[model samples]
Target: MSEQRTHSPQEPQRRPRITHNRKKTRRSKAAAALLYVLFVVGLSAVLATVGWIWANDLLALNKDYTSVIVKVENDESFGEVVNDLKKNGLIEYKFLFHLYGWFSNADDKIAPGTYELNTDMDYRALVTNMSASSSTRQTIDITIPEGYTIDQTFALLEEQGVTTVEKLQDMSANWNYKFTWLKDLPLGDYHRLEGYLFPDTYTFYLGEDAKYVINKMLVNFESKMGDYMDQFTEESQYSLHDIITIASLIEKETDGEDYGTIASVIYNRLENTGAETQGYLQIDATLVYLNGGKVPTEEDKAIDSPYNTYLYKGLPAGPISNPGMKAITAALKPENTNYYYYVLNPETNKHEFTRTYAQHQALVEKYGTANEEG
Candidate 1:
């Protein structure tokens, strides 16, 4: 039935060899699995170390307490911010901060200014401290007096280290400020915003932007003149610009209690264009403006300038100076009077108004004509 096979001792040995090879394969596989586990553990440790460092930087943790001043220039890129932070010891990792900035929109939030940063501030706090409304930024309190010309205002701002005069003048002339009332004003002249800069004390950044500096004053003017603006319309005889121009004249003419009376004289002169004044304002203050803030001489009257009320008719092209609320109110609500001419009396330091040229001449002779001498 079945053929009997002879068994060699070597056959048993070959079977044992096969078992040994299988054992060896199993041992090799176990070794590979242990190596893979060791590799994963090492990689995880490295990642955890890196993550901890980044987290420490982001949260401003465990670092020595230090304070530094960081200055971000106008239009500066975020790279520059990172460099400043790095240089000032405010941050240790520039690349990580940049990534955070990109994700958090820190570039848009951080404004150009001088900031006082300390080790206590986190990355988010640092970004906030550099913003336009930052409490840590340096500020200066300045008082811009009433009747200040735009030049005077700019000079004052420069003196207080708020901004450069050249920058202010440039922005005032060319910048297209977004305000409904400013639409009619044409650009190109620095004096275009003369009457609109409301005179008041303000708190401004030490090195503020020119646009923002000017905008603050303009916004103040709008806020103060809100009620008057509501009363004006397209059908009104005098626009807000005209009223401001008139107010400027009144502001320079007298500082006493004659605001309403002076305003009445101005209206009387303007309304009676056919009268002897011939629509010419004939104001000595305008001549002073033409003569570079000097007391106008008799020759200044003859020099041809649109601001010279003696030479040209109507409101001296624009406002001569910034007016306060009192002057503005007088301009809006002038006293009802029939007087057309006025002369400042030196003895009383008040203006004398009269309807006739002869009366004004008499008063001028008595008062020796104010601010007319060379």
Candidate 2:
């Protein structure tokens, strides 16, 4: 048995041969890896194609169309907006547009308005232009001139159909605004907001309440008066109301360049301690206001009105007109002078200032008329 085993071993030990199943298993693994790589590449290409189409749709997809007005209702939904764009031919891809809106968080931010849209607008432009609050409402441009009285301003607004006269009068009388300067104002007629409405150009929208416009003017007055607010402390001789009243007088009395000098004359007349000229402002403009814009006669000057400076000493009951910034500034910072009288020189359209009554009489004789008195 040993000799036979040795003879077989000499035939040698044949190594283990590779089976067909094993070779097939290795080839299968390589093929599976290659197929997986090919599948991944194909999926990536498909995704890239879809991304490019979506981006193109969001950008300049509709660049050659005419503009169209599209109205979005107040409680409209994003889906409804997308449908509206599709219906108006403003957008082509509804799904992609909605997706873009969702991604940009613009779906919830779209304002309800009548939007001016065009097929030439991209998704971004359409979203931006349609989101404005003003686009939904109608607006009017109103220009209120300087030195216009409240009555005058009301007339102008009524003429433009901005509001009714009754509404404006009602608001003016009873608004009870909380301005600090309006706190201690002397009780007067419904024109309590006389000088408080700062005169300037304004833009008012249609359908706005009367109080809205009034508050807008008051806010503008407060903003413009910010520069002079610090000067109106308790130590100052005049309140803000007093300064505005004086400024209104100065505005009606003289031109731009002579505001400071006219303010000085007003201050001199008020601050004078002399027995002859003490506490008498003698402003003819106040008499004009009392006479309802008419030239005041001697009888009109003697009328019993607090606004009559010829009768009542010191400033008038309130402002005579809404003065502009130039007059307001001059009233805040008056020229330091002893001049107490001024008369308009017809030859030069300027005021002639004088210190004493005698010098004032000289200017009156030189420049005054029977109807015009300083």
Candidate 3:
């Protein structure tokens, strides 16, 4: 300003204007850069928030442990399964679960059954639990006692909700079980598998197919009798069916205390068919079986039935009851003795073996009781 000596007016005004324009340009550029940074930061925060929510759902993070029972139909679609999960409060995001299922190919791996799922399970675990061999599938522990008849067993199965008795009966009669011993026994009779179903505690799936349930018992029976199968088939004069029949008789006769002695008496009676015993067996349990689980009266022995060992000679048509391993073994290997008669002693609650009719009559008179079984 002090040096304003003869300067041109157009030149001074041009310099000031150029400086002002440069300052304005620098301020505008700084503001633009700040606005761009704020925009980038805001977009990044929004994207991060969305990513966190998605990852949390996919991973099942921060979820309370809650159990839910899910039943998947055989023909249920993946969409239906996702809907069930949502309805059961197992999943938060149905679409996200569908996306995960699509990526993991879970549609092809799901199986038809009832499953027990929890909320803490991740997407991968959920898919795995829906598989055929899932451990989380619902199951029932059924203990079929020894001596359960086919009807009784089926009733128990139905009672436990494992299957219907009608279905079990139908399958038992029609299913052609692949086993050598089963060949001689024809179909069309549900009692064909009466003595073969093993009696043990079994874990069955809820609403299990009747065929599968029957197969499990049959397979268990085969495995349990595997060691004795060869012996019963080859060396023994009796067929495998015959052994089971005799064992069933023994099982129904006594309370497992006199199994071996009863077996000896039975063998003796069979051997001396022409002797005083006349091979009648005279087992009261047989009459009881034919009399509809009633205590056999004196007239009940005269009933005409193949299962009536008192009337029919030799073994019955089939097993009278499902015998345990002890009774079965006793039948396979009977004790060698000359006993042809036996009577239950009321005082001792055990059968007294006799070689002659006179001794048996004496015990019967002394005990003042008819025979329990022999």
Candidate 4:
């Protein structure tokens, strides 16, 4: 009765139903947008990952390795070679390497031999190197001992089938190397390069040119002298040739441990102001050099050759042999001492130093003759 104006049953709340439907539609739209955003981000991440993988596979990224030798047999296929490269850590992606080889037509062009390849090379360089005709050469291991003269070095090379003595002599005489140290060298026989060729183990290609082999030794000598070059030029009164000549004598005179003291003795003999031992480097090694590796007799010491240090004053004509770095360093920096004479003790294979001739004679009597055989 109070609501007498109620009429039928209202209109069933049309406004509320319309507002509810609008809210439901809004929620559905928001969920669809969120899902779209998530799909787009996922797709971008996948694309970035794929791009990085492709770039790394094709390009030589982060490749750091030394030289490696890979042997390819005559019967091996391109795929087999690639597999070997992959196994040797020369390459990263085998599939891409194979594809590159096929595309470049390098698969069939590869030579069958040992290839000296490095890891720093990219796929293109690696393939090209393998395909080249001069990809391989047989190498020989040659060891050049210290204190060997040029003649001895030539003999060793001839023994190893590296080159003939005549070829080496000719190369040494005529080849004009660009080393600054070689510019002022005395004009003479092949022995002019006597002490310059560094003594070390070397790998030379079989049947290599004589010039190439000799240059390798020279380059090594230059490299070994690295920082010492400036020091030698600045600190020493003697020229490089003179120092090398003295070093050769030191190398032949004693074992390595006494180089500095022996160098001092040589310097003392050459520079002594005393009337008795002044300017006479009475080294036995020079006599032996003059005598051609024979034991020096009393008559040999009296010979008038420029190399006879007993007869002539100052350094010899040139170096007697190739001395190693230890002897060279000693010649450059001799110990400061007043002692002028050293007699080799046969029992100890060491020398006894003396400042006076009387002391030297006593030591000679006590230690036996300096020429006693070791």
Q: Pick the candidate with the highest TM-score.
A: 1
Which residue segments of model 3 deviate by more than 4 Å? 1-66, 70-114, 118-130, 232-236
lDDT of 1 at 258: 82
Candidate 3, residues 164-276: lDDT per residue as tens digits? Answer: 78888888899998888899899998889988888889998766778888999989988888788877556668989988888888887755587887788888887788978
- Using all chains and alpha carbons, the TM-scores for the candidates as numbered come to 0.74, 0.63, 0.69, 0.62
> In what order do the candidates fall by TM-score, top score first?
1, 3, 2, 4
Per-candidate RMSD vs. true structure? 5.8, 13.1, 9.6, 18.3
Error of 2 at 103 (Å): 30
lDDT of 4 by residue, 145-202 (tens): 8899888999899788666788788888888888998988754578789999889999
Of the two candidates 1 and 4, the one with more favorable lDDT, higher being better, is 1
Better of 3 and 4 by lDDT: 3
Candidate 2 local lDDT, residue 166: 68
Q: Which stretches of candidate 4 lie over 4 Å from their true place?
A: 1-136, 186-188, 232-236, 370-374
- Pairs of residues clashing in candidate 2: none
Q: Give candidate 1's root-mean-square deviation (CA, Å).
A: 5.8
Q: Name the TM-score of candidate 4.
A: 0.62
Worst ten in a row by lDDT for model 3:
8-17
Q: Write the per-residue lDDT of candidate 1 for residues 168-188, one digit (tens) a residue.
A: 999999999999999999999
